[model samples]
Target: MKKIFKLSLPMLVIISNVSVGISQVNVDDRQSVENAKIVGQLHGLEGDTLTLSYWVNALGLDETSSYKRAFAPVEQKIIVAKDGSFSVRIPVYKKLQYFSLKSNRQKTIWKEEYFFRKGKMDDISTSASVPVLNWSYFILEPGDDIKVVLQHGQMSFSGTGAEKIKYLNEFKYSQNRPKSFQSFRGDSLSTIKRISYYDDLQQFGINILKKYHGRISPMAYQVLQADIIGHCQYYRYSSASLFNSYKDPTIRRIYLNIYKEQVKAKALPLLEQLSTEVLGLSKSYPLFWQQRFKVEQSYLLYNAHGDGVETQQASKNDLFEAVLNLKKGLLKDKLIVMNCSDMLKVFGQVQVEERLATALTELQDPTMYAVVKRFRDDFSKGQLTYDFTMEDVEGNHVRLSDFRGKVVFVDIWFTGCGGCVSVAKAMRDKVEPHFEGKDDVVFLSISIDKDKRMWKNSITKDAKRDPKLSYQRPGAHYSGDKTIYLRTLNGSDDPFIKKYVTNAYPTLMLIDREGKVFAFSAQRPDGGKAKLLIDQINDVRKL
Candidate 1:
């Protein structure tokens, strides 16, 4: 079935511990080991280097189309021996946590989530042949241990809690198989049919859970039940795929024209049913409030678009009324902030800033009000660009502030991103030639490719290419003139890139000479708006 209630788990690498000549811990003997922390050992790794990254979910700001919510993740990374036989202790939080094991040479990554109670040690062993290594068999006792055996494309788990883990894994595997829900097309499925399919799927999930209730933890069963119910409500009230397809204006308009009347007819009754269901569910569920707000926001956006009310055309009062109509609480406060942030992106910083200033007075939750204010203050124009030091192709360290007195156009990209590569080619052809000899303008290309070798290889290949485009220069890489500053993130997460909220690859930015941000998100070099870079440079010079 289509994944119901997808979890937002951001992978954050924390630390790396490499050990040699370390003795592997036997799973049978781990029961006697102190259960102070979670310890893991991997067996048959193919590569010389293995990376373990741990991620913890934190309540921070998450922005979607300029709307901020409360969800962020902190990650830490650790490197282990490639022999796949190293042991390390990981600190455990009170809540659930997630980690990943990545083989650099094999190009394989295994990710899994687990709950680590105090004084618990998790012993894991897997080989290169293991189809899955993460969370396959986890012994949950304070000091319990488990072993996973993978051979000939088959996997088996053994340990104190093996039965429970095996049952859970089998149930999850069955649920993940391709189902009819995956083929349900948004445009083809009627609203009633869509609702019916989701309801049927939800009932199926509940039945499965009931069948296996005695075999799983009560907490796990409750969480899964809540997730199933929330997903059903979300899909029934708001067409899942239809909401996502709104990114393309043409598709959005077409779907609206075809389904507007039907949606108008059925939306209220569906929403009413959803509201009643959400109100009946306890507040302890993770998706309880989130689901309600999601349905409400989706409904509002659906009606607004159908009525041809563009965000720009909608006044601040209109936005306020939309938010005010929602039930007052944390959800309403968050929705208000989200609406204001959306306005900020649509109506420019000044207008949205004023709107938020007015909203703070009416907002009940001080934390959300502070979050909105902080977003406004941080994203305002003229703020100093976040500085970062990255390694260039020649191994020279380049700091963003080094070009403080020159207008810098930064192209944030990676090696595998096709869009990023296309934009880079366009910049090299049409944009770079415009200021070939102008020392006041610098074109900076920063690659966030985690693989340093791949980054270097791509740069070397690009340097050799002499595209015969209209703006082709004598050499693609300036024949060693170093006109374009090429840098790599070098596997570390650069704060400078994150400061601009670069969720998309090939994010272009224009920084003014005074080390302040001119445009946090600029036009693509391949588009007609690419000329705006030059205009922005001229405008900054005049300032």
Candidate 2:
């Protein structure tokens, strides 16, 4: 049997300090202070398995060498008892960070996030009687009893820091009001009206902060303030994209005639206002502020370069000129790496390599430059994909190398991904039919679903069957030779997934006949892309 090794608190403290190089305060000179431990008793959990994971910002390199931000999971699992109860303690490194608690049953899973702080114990509990997963957080200082009650969809806390949690709950509830303001209905509103609407929302958020003035912690209040500002900026940027409708020629012509210049006029002022607010909040909340800055910069750049077309078709000199124009900082360096990497993916290595080489010269941070170099080394084409074994819905094992000598189209997905389901439907309706008789081609669906039953249900039953609402199929049934196979990763944190860097859901990849990766990130199985996959397969066959 494989031995399971858990990280002790001391080990976690050492690792966290060493890996991130964050400062540490000595409490007694014998033990250095580190992450806070959260202990909780969960009652009325419907699932047999529970998963706890925290988010960390990770840099992802796509097939094009473009860098994208991904929140990678550092997860741990707990076993629930027969009476729907479990006790767990999780360590959190950041003072203000988010952690998810996921309960997995045979048919369904319940997941929710809780805010945490280091050097504090958060005792939270929830019951199945509550319609939603509502948590009551309380700060415990070494020697306090832990308990929380779920009443009428609200959590009641009685321990230390209870008032703060109550205020947080109220704030969360207030923010949950209808999001209809975000929706844009075909340019019914003028450009000025749209900008004013976002401004009003920003003011409304400020009013929320003022209403809860003395009730919440100062840190929590600042975080909420930053969140509101970020949301307002995002809404304005998103509204611009919606109003433009670049894909719809008729809408584009109509919008450009009336509101194009007016919208462009408002963009700079809005971004400038956001910049002032973000800069003010940067000292107290650097990460949140940096994230907001990144988004705003992306929007500004997107608008400046004719939306996306100019950037997509930009030459090496044009790309460098656009990148170098941005203000110098770690954020700007990251953005340049991201854009250059994206260009490489969309335009291919030959077209974007010169531009990437030029951009690398501008990168002052060794860590960021190393990320780009590692991505380039790992994601290059014609490289052999990481081989691994996974079990089919039945108890049988299947190896990736088993499909050697045949071209493989691998679909990396999970049960909860809606995009993955839609692509699966497309594969069933379109891609599968086109290659009905192809012997050299194969379709492999690899699900990283934590629940085995969900994976089995998806393949054996109709695509329309809802596992939550209906009965699940017992196991998958597939012929050995026809190329279509449904397989599941052994666990949520499977090494195979980490090796492939399969961060995005519904990621498609096409493997050459000799098991070498042809397209590291292939087109989704939707629209005419399915036909394109067939064409590529035929072209590969000839070669």
Candidate 3:
């Protein structure tokens, strides 16, 4: 069985099992940590010196363990008391919280995360209200109280009124129309559309769009029209609405294009449009939270793929240039907080490389310092490559180099790797059928230990024989020797692995065939939302 570290613990109990130096893993099946209200005191213990400090979980449980703290950025957070005597509680039906650890001192440790799960209210020993937390195990000596709360604790999910699905229509009236265009002005309408994607009232500004596209895609594409101010009120609102789905690039492009056009078209309102659209994109895709858990669990084995603190901080410098250039607040923080990935990947591509040099001039950029720390490494010398290759069960001779012109999903696995097998099986059931004929991409699994006979035997035991997944990797390798495709190369032969070394089993490396370096790597290939993978593949198609 695969060990799922990043999961909702439906086995609720607010069970904060301590493992001396390891982190606390909170399990929840439904809701976020914000839903599980908490009020607590954080402490630190080194040699029996107990010190109380300010902390916050004012909204949820503080599940950060020693290992968990390594994966998250270091800021203020509720610390379990030193000496390991901390009050821990979990309210029934509460929202789970997710966060990683960081430090102001040493380099950022990437694989530490805290995910709290929900359980029944009557099952726990504490009162329903938030409880006081005083933990002791590791040594943390500061308070981490949040300055303000962004969300509140919900008493129930099945309640009526504001909590009910019916309450969405109320947001329909909150739209602030672009400054110049009159809603009724037919001459100002450049394009009209109806989208099925919008069904929420919280993004009420889009009500105008739905009203316009009464037919056609009124089902998927909610109405969003650009006005003189270049701001598509509906687009701005929809980006923040939880109803927004991740698969739609046509929509993300519309927002991106609108931002570009407004700036090019000249505007007293360009900043306003860019502000709404740019920050909105981050809200739509919270990349920071997306990989937090994986890093928390496997940082030493995986790559977090970004600069250190300063680099992380400077990257968000231009997110909402118009608004952030003028002022700083939640908008700025949200832009920097949520979009740490795009700042390095997609946005990095669009930027001038020298801008990185300029960002380094700031003296506080953690990226340059990080680069200096690894300056002798392969990435600095431009020697990095995704050099490893593997054959599929069909004996297709699929190498990472073979997919050089397109995007490649490189599954680094062995026959006995349960997580790897589970993900491949999942792809067959949950996703592969959805894209039955997509030939634009290729998926390959590379075995580290070279054993062709063992490989074939394992394939027979797995693909042809598994019952729980009901997945048969039908076709090649099974019919004859020609049916099985297997490639094996030790990490020693692969320069890519040598550059950024790793030892984790069943690692997933998403690579670009064009450049052939690793795009993203994960240990739990199928655990969380597949949006990150979906987004990368979609991005390639757009190119």
Candidate 4:
């Protein structure tokens, strides 16, 4: 039986608004070594090339956008000249930073399922492409100097903090597409239309900051009101599993009694503005305080497993008593170093050093205890793995520890992936005919395709497979059928696809036989898990 409730337990006791109207912009840690000047102009592209990144450190907003595949530790390319000017100065890592300038040949190569779709924008900039003539977020400071131009594709700005992001390049891109929510339409009409679709997107971003009040800059108007309440509480706790596939307890107590008689008293003051004093001005406040601490730790494990609430399972001492029922400062020390960087990426590093010894005195921010002790000295389990180098399809290169004593099974795909062609048609029908002739098993596959002719037309095709041109043709002769193709030699910026794909993909690893890592998310020969990926490659070839 499923009828689950706790749609984030009635917006969990309206967040104690730490007197909104956000603050924190004092600067001085030697103003991150001061510099900031960015003159611009690029009328007709001329000698091309442009880039101007930022985000030198917002500790990757305590990760969770499929662990944000690392990049942008400050970039800067530019080139342009032939009469269409350009200038650069950068360095201000503190007071009101955020930048982006684009057009390094309108680049676009990224896929962690496009960060949950629908025009994803934090003033645009994801695995690129969202700048019909760029310059996103753009709010500089230390020793200010601004001034930009662009022309045909229209973009402008002028001297010293030009009216703070000139209404973000003239706003109205249909207000970053909000207002969605309809799926499970019963549990109180999908819980009062998903709390009035995030209170009409926090009153349409406070009526566009009261129609551009004081022309925007009090910390870019609280980072656009914490990017409209962190995209309405990150799409309301990532659409809290819309009533976990409904189990009809009389149509869920008849629309949870019409959401406690017509939407629980005007939706608890629009879910008390999901406050935590919009912490240190927006990179959307730690992804809206890690989606409001995973919706109050899933309403404290659905009130501690009340009647088989989907087979309860939230350990690590139930995530340290649901973050010791939070209250302490700096957003509970940045959600205790983003709960030890999501418990060292799913319970590893000996369970985040045994919950950092009871989370080391509730970790009082020394930059969140040195960012969870640098994610516990960069977590490692079975270790070894990263001998990277890939490129096959004639350009040769290969290397993952030169398949040392085999047992590989890598996968990691791209180039129009329909779930990597349904796990390469379940590894060509039920796991390569059960490892027929396994010389210590291999399989491989890689890709992260940065267009080596679309990764050699998606692994050198075979024929007769057009489920509507299977995501740009893919039938999988992944290297003459049995699978062994490669390609990531710097494709998705390969540092072995950013240290084992945290910008996800069809990523499935395994390794063993001394090449180490026995599964950084393995098992996926599609639906009928191909005899559980052939019994986890025969239990990692019997270790």
Candidate 5:
């Protein structure tokens, strides 16, 4: 499943701690050593490294870049000894937290292959080593010491909580079998095929969990079950978007009937199992919690549309109203916390403050209210945005603060992003003409590409204009003086890129005349939001 909540787990590869002798606990970790420990032995893995990571926040509401800084995952790496033995102590949590292990040898084929529009070849066109994580997950909590044994990538467990961990691993291995579904053609057949694929996938996962029912703790089993259901439900919800593009009357009617009969019918019973009382289990699987809310909200909206309800009490996508449909408990309160970002993005500050005020009145549990309040106060309009300095094409140092008195439109992107190129085309063709000679505004494009030669070549023209290379890319279109483009000093390793711009590319931000943020996520210059972006620029200038 595509990850909806981009957990800001640090992927920054730490230098191998080869010298940090195994089983050595620091004085400060004496208490944690008593509480939590993992002792493991490995074979055929003496040269590789192992990384252990676990979430600090259980509810997965750490959505913003700032929140992630405060509650990032606690990750530690240990290099295997020649004897194939290693030991490490990790921080403990009160709840049954989900912990995962990954190896330095693990990697995915590069996602940037053939990013150039034309199927082309070059030193850069071949696959690069990207760290796409495939984690082996297990449950960990306070007062647990587990010993693990691994031989040639096969792992077994013993000591406290061994059965639970063993069962979790077994379930993971079962689900890793190769599966495929019909490719999306944005038609009725594609939609039906997707729904059937997820249905079978969810059932397959549930059967695996059932096989180990008594062997695993009830809490662990419940969480795993919710995860299986949530994953399938999230896909069902995402598939609803297909109706937006292909709106044939006859096809849509048949699609809605199949959806109501099969999709909705299957999801309701599964969703019921994830009630408010089980909110504590949510922390161990934050993605499950996040997907649960999305699934619930989509169910309500689609139900209303299917019934042909002309008059609704609330707006179509109003999450607050959807939350009200749930029982009064911690689940309701936490979902409200998760909805704060969506409100801020869609309705802006005034509505967010008003909603939070109203939410406070109804909140039965305030554990996450602080997060909502902090997000509201910190990202409020007019906050001075982070200042960055980088080298332009001429190697001249330029700082964001230098353009303090101008309205700055910032685009954060990298070499292989297609959306960035499309947005650049839209900006060049549509938005730039209006601000052609405006001195009060600036267009800044920052790239996270690592190779300076590749960066330079991308921005400059191919003298040959090989018809094969005639495709319009962000670098080519953004190369001109009309746009001031700069590349990050160390590519993805740059601190600014790591800390602020996590994951999403083609991110657009609007900075006001005082170098304060007007919009953290501004609209793209596409057909739908181009006029609004133009108006936003004009409006920010007036301030």
Candidate 6:
């Protein structure tokens, strides 16, 4: 456990590191001055049952994949031990919700909002308090229960800015949840002793009449849809910014035997077609369509991580319409798919109105739809509407709609883009002073090059030739919520250069808090990948 960020004036010196005895109960007085607490031990990582399909890749939360789930008021649980050993807990509670609790307690799927409290016992040296910004606290209340062991580290990494995240502050541990250590799964077709568990529920079309449409029942949507496409990315590094582990046990048994033979033949006709025609969870998909299935199965990572022998030039219906367009979070078509969280919320409201025909008519779809809305308005909404407006160095008009209820990145670039202003000044002198001024988040920036006064006098007289900077949080921009961010950038006509006609300049876009849009990139955000976007804005401020 290690997190730190500095920039004190009125506030912003985050500094997170704990473990060596932990404690925190925090009922939430707006998060009791935040009450920082860090403790590790996925218990004794490594699989045997409660790997419970590794809880959406260990709470980084992914119905698709924008990434988040580091560790927050966590309260996770698991049981088994006559002497076998395995009883985990993490109490801090009062965050939104998350839990693979091991994928609904390894398919026991009860979820009264996280469970396990028979007579609540303890003694794995009892004491678990997790509450960092990103997700990992596993919140467990309602009849609360505590007791854990199964620990973790060998350095479960993350770090950023002032340059030494110490590789994300090495609070290290590991017995095995590196996604269970031995299971290579890029997208899944089958694994776990000869496949058959609903074969990724009809490649996530989840049919049996649309698997009970959101209220969930066709037996809890065939057990959380075969625990999210046959157990969420085989486990570990579920994103909340950056954590990518691969360890190869033949590539985690070929991604758990092609996600256990596509969740035993497309998880009950895609949960009966989203329990017959989308009632809830609408018609979406992705927890990671591997960046659009590596651009149409870039030959399955070049035929198993590189060209060894075969290369028939892609066919088997183009690899089953590229694994059904990476389970519908992509594929402009062989039959259509696109849902990656509604194309990252209409491509972040069509790049705040640089209107690629209203962001391809709000990402509706028409096959190569304006070539996928000019490739998501020139790669993720032109570095997030590069300079729709600006003025910083503290004069502060700033305005990405004043950050609108939090979570905003905007982040375009060009100090001549190479190491892009030293990775944007090491993400603004180390992760924007560990989430500056202590609001939910706001990392601003936008300079496509019209010359905001030579980039505001090169960010106040060459702060080392513009090392990059942008941030927002405090009363979060401004949000009466017509979907904020300047009402999604007012909507067109110079609307951020009529959909990127100015062309790409280190784009970064990421927006949320009602403004929609969550990710887009022109490149260079890696101060250890802003520790997975500061653990997905500390897991959306714990939902």
Best by lDDT: 5
Clashes of 2: 4
Q: Estimate each model's TM-score.
A: 0.54, 0.56, 0.29, 0.30, 0.74, 0.28
Best by TM-score: 5
Better of 3 and 5 by lDDT: 5
lDDT scores in order: 0.48, 0.49, 0.32, 0.58, 0.59, 0.34
What's the count of clashing pairs in each model shown?
12, 4, 54, 1, 1, 127
lDDT of 5 by residue, 1-543 (tens): 221221121222332432211001111211222245777787766667777666534443222322233233555676777897877665553346656666676444532211111222222324556322234446676666788887765677888767667666665455463254533544555566667777777778777778887876676667767666765666664565444334465655565665566566763575576655554445423344444455445445556665343212233355577676767775675566556545554454456567766665555532344445445555567888777778898989888899988999988876667788777777877787889889999998888877665566556644233344334342453633578878888875565555444236676778998888888667777645778889988988898
Query: Which residues of candidate 4, in runs, are more than 4 Å off?
Result: 1-48, 52-79, 83-99, 102-136, 139-161, 165-213, 217-223, 227-286, 293-295, 302-390, 397-410, 413-442, 447-485, 493-502, 509-531, 535-543
**Residue-by-residue lDDT tens digits, candidate 3, 1-543:** 322223332222333332211012232233333222232322222122222211111101123311121112212232344442333232322111222222111222122211212311111222232122112111111121221111232111121111211112222212342112111111111211111112122234345444434332211121122121112333323232211222254543343343334312332332234443233222122222222221222222212332122322232343424223423332333322222223332333224233333322322212112322231232221233545454565665455565567655655555555566676655554444444467666655455546555555555523454343323242212212212234564432344443332334455555554644444343232555455556655665555
Model 2 lowest lDDT segment of ten:
19-28
Better of 3 and 4 by TM-score: 4
Q: Model 1, range 1-543, lDDT digits (tens) per residue? A: 211121222212234442210001101221222321333344554333544433221111111211212222222344544544434344323222223344444424333322122333233433343333443212132233445444553457665434445654554455452233332344434444555566666666566667767655444444445545655655554553254445566666555543444333443232233332233221222233443444445446656666344422333436567666766654466556556545543444456567767666655543455455555666667988788888887778888888888888877766666666667666666677777777887778777766555555565634442343222222222212334546656442466655554235666777888988766556665646558656666776666
Scanning candidate 5 in windows of ten residues, the lowest lDDT window is: 20-29
Question: Clashing residue pairs, candidate 4?
Answer: 188-255
By TM-score, the better pick of 4 and 5 is 5
lDDT by residue (tens digit), candidate 2, 414-480: 6566667677766776677777777788888787766666666666644455547443333232212
Candidate with the larger lDDT of 5 and 6: 5
Indicate whether candidate 2 or candidate 4 has the larger lDDT. 4
- The superposed Cα distance between candidate 5 and the true structure at residue 454, in angstroms, equals 6.7
lDDT of 1 at 331: 46
